[model samples]
Target: MSLHPFSQRPRYSQWFTAKPQTVVVQPTTWCNLDCTYCYLPFRRLKHEMSAEVSDALAESVAAFADGAHPIDIVWHGGEPLALGPRKFTALLTPFEELRRVGRVHHYVQTNATLITEAWCELLTRHEFRVGVSIDGPAALNSQRVDLRGRPAFDRIVRGIDRLRVHDIPFSVIAVVGTDGIDHPEELLDFMAGLGCRSVGFNMEEAEGINTDRQQPTPEQAETFWRRTLEWSRCHAGELEVRELEYLGEYLRMIRAGQRVDWDRRRLDPIPTVSWNGDVVLLSPELADTTDVGYGNFLAGSVLDRPLTDILGGAHRLRYVQEFLAGLEGCRAGCEFFDFCRGAQAANRYFENGSLATTETNYCRVTRQALVTALSTVAAKEKEETV
Candidate 1:
């Protein structure tokens, strides 16, 4: 895990907190629906995790959680519920003993395609937080179809209906496409109707297998955020839009003229683990991607190594080294460096073809434009107050 002297300094070390507050585990890679913009390269591989491996990972993570800081295990997959009742139960059974004395919370990000009554009961009993992935209404979710190319929107709606009936509180994460960009207010209204307390927006990214992505201009992004802000004010305390939340926090820190600190949570690999115990550090999106130098973006295997050792193994991956160097370049060059430290690794790698670069079309539209838009709105409000 040793690195050259020059690569020793990481910007993350400057802002110290818990390195990985969350670990995303892929219990299986067998997803039912094939969303057009999915980044999972092995979404149809049907690889299920061995209980032995799961037990070993839990042991490793439980030891990490023993340090007294609360950590979360985010169960993700091609889709977690795809593991079915017996298998999913077995997957989580490893944590039963660990949960008694430690602060290890369970969460699952699902497509909600297979959320049944049984699933709700299991989640509730275990107190697993749920995040459903769905884009707006049926028309907006046309790209999220089944293997047979038929729209699965109706099934998704049915699942949401069941979640509501069961009194399960959940958040929604939607991929914003050209259609979403064109109709921001309409998209917001649709998700609010579904009873989601908070909504996360991931603009169509150029990552993994999905290479054919069209990015909106910065002006278009700013306009969309402005409109969405106006719509959100109408429902103020009810709906929480994640993008606006991040931007607003950034603006507050800047306006107060305080020394800014980076959010370690969003900074890097939040530690994504595969079914077989392969640990991909830093970028969750790096789980399914490959680099010539780092192979499958793996730093270490929890089944074979300690979590402490795996984190040390980060410097061993040239991909991470390059990412660290790229982050240095970003700090030196970009005006937005304080707000975003080189952006997400997968997006930077996929869009710019290198980690040591900055400012892709992705950042230009989302982070940069949102900042401009929010600042403008704030300035206008201040003038009106005068």
Candidate 2:
């Protein structure tokens, strides 16, 4: 029987009729630091969410958690800590209640500068998995400075030290810039010495508010990642590298005879809910656009629209379908699609004009570097076994 395009049945669903497994909630559009690479342009904004709105959002998410699937709530930009301790705790009450019944997991992605002793205590008390943003050591962190052109390394280090002193387990996220590309071994050593249990490395994405004049070239990126992997193999201690997480997950899928979720061009359409209850599709970078499809916040006020209505809107549905179709191209053609998440929508929007486009420059660099390194490692292992 000949396969029909529409009837072929995408390995993943074509549309989302249910709530997302993970939802990113922004408590305030305010941020303390002016990181050059921030996607939110948060430093320019002063919109703080009211406690009432935060409560309503929690209730809306709670409604979604009414289902059986595991749910994760991520406190995302612009610096969720800007919500302050009292408001942050207020926002947590609804989700925390759900956790009592063992129904929810909470995560926070933050720039460690705002991390205080109190914040560390609350995070550890609630068992929240924290991911701190720090781009390697002081020298490499020069680019990741405040608006006043002051290096934030000392403050960030102090914040991290507070976490350590308070016995709060946390992970580090380092942005790999051109400088970092030149010293992969040094960067890895710096991160390892921080005593963070895990680390995630992100290429300085040239998207949103991040208009960094200089970015690493594709060749530089490839070399940096290649060397980083070699360093990782040699230092295979308690350190968990987030960049390798997707690859590890993909390999796990292969071992289990299963397909990866993000790799299949599937739209896991993680919703980023702003403090005032506006929902943006995928990452916060999409929320930074001035264009129609760019800052397309389809669903507003979860109190007004049913979660079903928001997920089923024509714009959202079309975007999801188009995104999935784009993935089909990857699955059919790209050899490295299984390992990478086909590049992020934010990178595509910034580099190309649209999110539905084919492989991105980021993808090209990552796939070429990662696959080559993995192949070399596998071959060496085979030879050693022989």
User: Which number leads on lDDT?
Assistant: 1
lDDT at position 117, candidate 2: 75
Candidate 2, residues 132-172, lDDT tens digits: the string is 88988888988767768788889889888988898878888
TM-score of 2: 0.87
Tens-digit lDDT track for model 1 on 1-386?
Answer: 23673555454354223356888999998899998888889988899999988888888877668637767889998888999988888988888766656668888998888999999999888888899999998888888998888998999989888899999999999988776788887888898899987998887888888898675667888888778887877778868999888767776876887543434434535788899888887677788676656676878888889776677556656777777777777778888877765657777788888776677877877787777777777787899999
Clash pairs, model 1 backbone:
268-282, 269-282, 269-283
Question: How far off is residue 148 in model 2, in Å?
Answer: 1.7
Query: In model 1, where is the ten-residue run with the lowest total lDDT?
Result: 9-18
Best by TM-score: 1
Q: Where does model 1 exceed 4 Å of error?
A: 1-12, 15-18, 254-268, 379-386
Candidate 2 residue runs with Cα over 4 Å from true position: 1-12, 15-17, 66-68, 259-267, 293-297, 314-318, 341-343, 379-386
- Model 1 scores a C-alpha lDDT of 0.80
